[model samples]
Target: MSEIGATPDPGEIKDKIKAGSDRANALKAYVDTVSIKHVHRQDIEMIDLVVKTYELLTEIMKLVESKVDEIGNAKK
Candidate 1:
């Protein structure tokens, strides 16, 4: 029998990744829905920064997903 509290299964890791990606996508959608014009000029720069950060985060998630795929393939 397998030992208890062993290394996590790849499937579990993938599930966590999917959950995180889903949340990130939801946050991105929320950010995209905010009207730029509604933001005061003084805070516009901050808003722009936030949007860029979110874009970068989305890219990072894609990279992570690719890595996960690589791991799965390696095990096959």
Candidate 2:
């Protein structure tokens, strides 16, 4: 735990988010390559939802990294 008035580390935050993004990307790859012999309508819908969610997550990750960079710049 950080002490009172301690500033949080932006690098640590970015690293953690990047790690999660990497895992998400790996799962996306699996989703892209998995073979479904008999894909149902529901399966298709779910896959579509996942793809959209991933796109949004990608945007969010970019936003976070941008914010981190901004903070670092402000500190400099």
Candidate 3:
């Protein structure tokens, strides 16, 4: 939420990005640990799907960071 007509802050946006990345990483780790402990024949596909999804999210976050840097440089 922003005050009306308030300009967005890149620093704040970067902080948010960092936080999201951290959470994604934490979830990925937890999933990996849990899967290792409890993987089953019927659940393998679901686990793989979840792990791949997190991998995609991580890659997307990296791309977002790159784009932010690219845009900021262009603005300068």
Candidate 4:
């Protein structure tokens, strides 16, 4: 609360998003150039499968998050 009208301090939220984006970019870059020379073929295959599963999970999370946002906005 404030005496009159005042803007909120949104810098922390913005910084968090920027940090997340930076981390995502770094992970993408590393995944792009990742190799598995020391690991066996089956182990490498399992790693690839896990990566694909994670990608699918991320996609589904985006859809659910958007639906939640829609519901929240509808209430307003």
**Residue-level lDDT tens digits of model 1 in 1-76:** 2258875566777788788878877877877788877788767777677778877877887788788788888888
Off by over 4 Å in 1: 1-7
- Estimate the lDDT of model 2: 0.85
Greater-lDDT candidate between 2 and 4: 2
Deviation (Å) of 16 in candidate 3:
1.8
Each candidate structure's TM-score, on Cα atoms with residue i matched to residue i, is 0.68, 0.85, 0.73, 0.54
Clashes of 2: 0
Off by over 4 Å in 3: 1-7, 35-38
Superposed Cα deviation of residue 30, candidate 3 (Å): 1.0
- From the highest TM-score down, the ranking of the candidates is 2, 3, 1, 4
Q: Report clash pairs, candidate 2.
A: none
Q: Model 2 Cα displacement at 66 (Å)?
A: 0.4
| Clashing residue pairs found in predicted model 4 | none
Instruction: Tell me which residue pairs clash in candidate 1.
Output: none
| Top TM-score hit | 2
Alpha-carbon RMSD of each model: 3.6, 2.0, 2.5, 7.1
The lDDT-based order of candidates, best leading, equals 2, 3, 1, 4
